[model samples]
Target: MNDLERQSRILGVLTERPFASVRDLQIQVGVSGATIRRDIEKLHEAGRARKVYGGVAALDGLPPRAAALPFFENRDIAVAQKRDIARAAAAIVRDGSLIIVHGGSTCFQFGCEIAHRNVRVFTNSLPLAGYLGEHGTCQLTVGGGDLHREPGILYDTSGAGHTFYAAQFFVGALGISAEGLLEQHPLLVRFTAEMGRLANEIVVLVDSRKFTARPPTVTLPLSRIGRLITDSDLSDEHARMLEDEGVDYIIAPRGGEA
Candidate 1:
């Protein structure tokens, strides 16, 4: 099998079982020990699974993810990189365009940058919605429902269909991988999936660090993503992998870029 096929099988094992040792993966994938080790490295680098001793572990370990850095506090985690990504993302917003935006600090930066545009934005982020409402030249609509405290996002868990539609969805990821985007919360998976249905295209905005780790659950898949705007620090290996998958990997200029 090809690398993609082998990697896909490894991911399936990681998903079904908590951990997969190299020997076990070798037996299951019908590959050699060296091949399994290389597959593990590829999975780890792609943010699908993490390496632990002689095996790969699912992102399901660790705490329940009931906690997250507060919204204001998260603003400084990677401020410049987020800004660069936002700037690149904002360029795609044309006048009178309609788009959907999800919640996160990176996405918040995107909201802040695009406040002067003529597009109408539909969002689930409380801060972003409020910012657009107060200062954005564009029209702003907030998704109404329960408020999630950690990130202060509004999601309708009622399982009701969304009423709005947009040409694009600008979303951020806590974790990203070749297989898909990941997030700790199941609520976010449902929300993003629902939001994705309303848009003709999905644009993911995440920094380079997010690529090193996978979150507990898959929120969206790589196939659904039209474009990914990230910082310049993303590795060439990942860039090539994304190219192979047909994802438009946009490298936003960071402070040190040429």
Candidate 2:
């Protein structure tokens, strides 16, 4: 298997359990010990895993049930930009449309923008799901999986118990570049790809700041993104990059202007 695929498998194992021995990863990933070691080293460097004596462990060894403090920590960063982008994205959701909303602070803002809309939403965000369940009029379906609190995403590596499709998938990125939408966590990389497969089009919701933040792993290529929505702060150079990639984009106006 390739590096991305093998690393994803290793992370899957780590997510299902707390730690995975080098031998276990070798057997599961079907790679050599040296390959597993290298993968673990990379994961460790990316802050997604911790290297132990004989195995690697998920970051902090925290269970999936803990409260997602990180989500709240990020909820307030770039608040105005996220709200503007959310409003723009909300406009794209027609009444009675079905859409998949992936987990992230930015996506949570998008969820809030559509909380009372007459649409159907399938989401993996605990925060979004909770907000929608309490305040939304739209029909909602949540993914069945372990809730990873650090990233605030619910995902099942097995892809079990999920059988829905949507016209569009709305997601966020840790970083964006010529390589594609980047994420630091391997599970997120895998789950986002799975969600993309279930949608006819992919809509990216990212703040302009992410363009310069270079996360290490690419989740989707530029070709896969059908449209991108960002705040007005996006630079001309980055906008040209999207245009060159044939990606349709919208720059949301600030301060509630139309």
The TM-score of predicted model 1 comes to 0.72
Q: TM-scores, in order shown?
A: 0.72, 0.72
lDDT of 1 by residue, 1-258 (tens): 999999999889867765666767778999898988898898889888887545676777563222234566456566788988999888887789889988999999999998998888898899998888888888888888999887779887787787767999999877777789988777778888888889999999998877765677888889999999999888888888788888988899876254
Candidate 2 ranges beyond 4 A from true positions: 1-69
Q: What are the per-residue Cα lDDT tens digits for candidate 2 across 7-103?
A: 8888888667555777767778788888989999998898888775345767753332212125665675678899999999998888988999998
Task: Tell me how many clashing residue pairs each candidate has.
Answer: 0, 0
Error of 1 at 28 (Å): 47
* Model 1 pairs in collision: none
Decoy 2 TM-score against native: 0.72
Q: Which stretches of candidate 1 lie over 4 Å from their true place?
A: 1-68, 255-258
For TM-score, the strongest prediction is 2
Worst 10 residues of 1 by lDDT: 61-70
